[model samples]
Target: MSTTTETLKSQWEALKAENPHMRIRNAAEKLGVSEAELVATSIGEGVTRLRPEFAAILTEVEKLSKVMALTRNDECVHERKGVYLNPDFSSPHAGLFVGEDIDLRIFLSAWDKAYAVVEKGEDRDKKSLQFFGKDGLAIHKIYTTRDSNDAAFDVIVEQFKSDNQSNEETTVAVPLDIDEKPDSEIDVDGFKAAWIDLKDTHEFFGMLRKFGVTRTQALRLAPSEEHAHKIEKDAIVKMLEGAAAQKLPIMCFVGNRGNIQIHTGLVRKTMWHNNWFNVMDPDFNLHLDMDKIAQTWIVRKPTEDGVVTAIEVFNEMGEIIVQFFGKRKPGIPELTEWRELVASL
Candidate 1:
């Protein structure tokens, strides 16, 4: 090991000894390094580096049977327990795992580093496959549950293990500075027309791109009050509580730069832990830091079936923390109860 790596490893060990319960992500932030770098320090210990063949590795994930799929941004964490099925990698830039319980939208281009990790647990070893973005932050993670196929997990580890097992520090990319165009320059009339004429929710991104306006900016400049309007951030909590109380099946989406994990079902238990609001359900869990939310918008988009409504939450950085929509697929109109619930907010 190089002098620098040895120094980092020593520092990491000292930190862990001092704060054994600290998560590696927090430890990395404290040590002024990437989480991937900290995990790399244990390359030959409990961590095995995996090749960047993310799509292929994901294709083999189904063999492990039931696992927990986790995706998070800075403000929210989404976890869903399900089988990895229906692997689709036809697109070079992206992929999808369209299972009923665990649904994911994967962006292959953002995937950079991967590792197969095992940690000693109370009863047995905890196993997981973690993938990271170019920024050295985790994009997605799959953890083996008690019912998971341990033998299949071992097979996958051996199959895609990287030839290089060096504990090299991960490279962190410089944060991108994407400045949104001034709203004054946008064609308000044209943008509103396009938004009104939208047929699918998926076309929303294209409309934003066409107008060169950011998500929050578009919300602020919504042509009509019915189209979009700001609401109190606390509405998120109320929404969850209302959904749980009414047994309303809702869709919650949380994602970062690389992946978006969706949970389309009922949210049963809702509670608060410190500043974080949580949805503690059997098959799905969501931890959202309420303090990070800066703005909440009730956005309505026109669709062929009817108008679709969504509760979109954003952080101070103008990044989406989480989005809630009525559990409905294409060709279906928005649920009246959901629309009423959002309108009540």
Candidate 2:
């Protein structure tokens, strides 16, 4: 190893000795390096750098039955439990994982480094495959569960192990700034007209790109109060409570720039502690920073089946923190009870 890397490794070891419970991401920040770089330091010990064949890795992931898929941003963490099935990787820049239990939207272009992590510590022995973006931010992670196929995981890890095992210092790229148009510059009438004529909920992203307007701007330009309206930030807690009371299965989407993790089921437990609104269930947990929620909107979109409504929460920077929707299939319409619950909010 180079002098600089050797010094970094010593520093990291010292930091770990100081606080063994520190997460790797936090440790990387404390050491002024990326998480990928820190994990690379343990290449031969418990980490194996994987070749950047994300699609192939995902295909192998399907064989490791009953794994937990985790995706997160700075403010929210989403975890789902299921097998990675029905993966569609035909697109060069994007991929889709359409499974009944584990649903994901993968942006292939942003995916950069990958590693298979195996940590046998005093307390626990954990195994996982972690993927990172160009900026060294985590895109997605797949962890082995009690019911997972450990043999399959071991085989895939060996299959994709990189030839290069050097632990060299690396630099992370700066994230690009989004060029969002101002609300005033958007054609309010035209945007509203197009929104009203929307055929499917999936077209919402296309509509935003076509008008060159951000999501918050579009919500502000909604034609009528019925179409879009701001709600109290605490409404999220109420919505969750109501859903649980009604036994309503809902879909929650939390994503970063590279991947979106979804949870579709009835949330049975809700807790608020330290300004975090959380769904603490046995298999799924959603931790959302309530203080980061700067705005909440009830948005309505016209679909072939009927008008679909959603509760979208945004942070101060106009980035979506989390979205909630009533669980319904494509051919079926939104639940009347869910619509009533949204209206009550």
Candidate 3:
């Protein structure tokens, strides 16, 4: 129970290989175990083994990477272009898509419980899980359930306290900027949508706090804005927290239109992205490991035109973490060019 999957399986396999003629029961005895246990353990080990599909996919991705060599000579990594800032406040690994509301009693609730499990395994430090979905989605979650009187929940709750989850104090209710008004003249819904779009996703609620967008403006801004507005972020979170109890339409940004819409039929889903983020507090563990932590990118073309290579991280659990869309970081003048383009936009 406290051994590596490889170590346990190796023992089992050695016994089986040494005596291929022995009966299954005899093989179990050779491994100093019961036949049922041996059989179940083998099956479990097989499940954890990377699937053939995954192995082949990895091989193919590696092969595709060779194309990076046949390109122009602008290989210098620049400041803005080469900088890969780690956004640790964002959830690690895996992107999930949420179709509808889900019962949180199991996977979602259980995950909040399981995180406290003793770090009983190897250094998953180099490993980042890639969940395939947006920031807030979670699919195929196996959760622990509890009723009103379920005493087990107490034990789980205690574990959280024993762990570091509760050790740190958090504060909310940020001081509003002078520019932030008590109210605005925009239509409540339309303005909210507009505000949400104009806000930044990776930054704190800067647009709302700094730009003085009203709730309606924030909401409107989110759908079409380049970033998230405070109200929009808060609204999305409220839907996620109560998802286990009731299903609600998780608002998704529909292209360039600033319209908000909801999807349904969520059951143990896991497709979400961590869009809103910020760094704060006495200690900055929030930003500890910011970039390229077990992330992957999909291989686009070997090379694209004048651009030699480009890459971005993906959170698909089994898919490659980062994919090169254009040129690799470190450019001659693209950084300045990009800054000017963004500013112009």
Candidate with the greatest lDDT versus the true structure: 1
Worst 10 residues of 3 by lDDT: 70-79
Error of 1 at 211 (Å): 1.1
The TM-score, computed over Cα atoms with residue i paired to residue i, of candidate 1 is 0.97
TM-scores for the candidates: 0.97, 0.94, 0.18
lDDT of 2 at 333: 98
lDDT of 2 by residue, 143-262 (tens): 998899989999999999999878873556866456677677888788899999999999999999898888888898888988899999888899999998899999999998888888
Give the Cα-based TM-score of candidate 3 against the true structure: 0.18
Q: CA lDDT of 51 in candidate 1?
A: 93
lDDT of model number 3? 0.25
Worst 10 residues of 2 by lDDT: 169-178
The local lDDT score (0 to 100) that residue 74 gets in candidate 2 is: 69
On TM-score, who's better, 1 or 2? Answer: 1
Query: How far does residue 306 in candidate 2 sit from its true spot (Å)?
Result: 0.9
Per-residue lDDT over 243-312 for candidate 3, one digit per residue giving the tens place of the 0 to 100 score: 3234322221111011111112221232333532222211110111123233322111111222221122
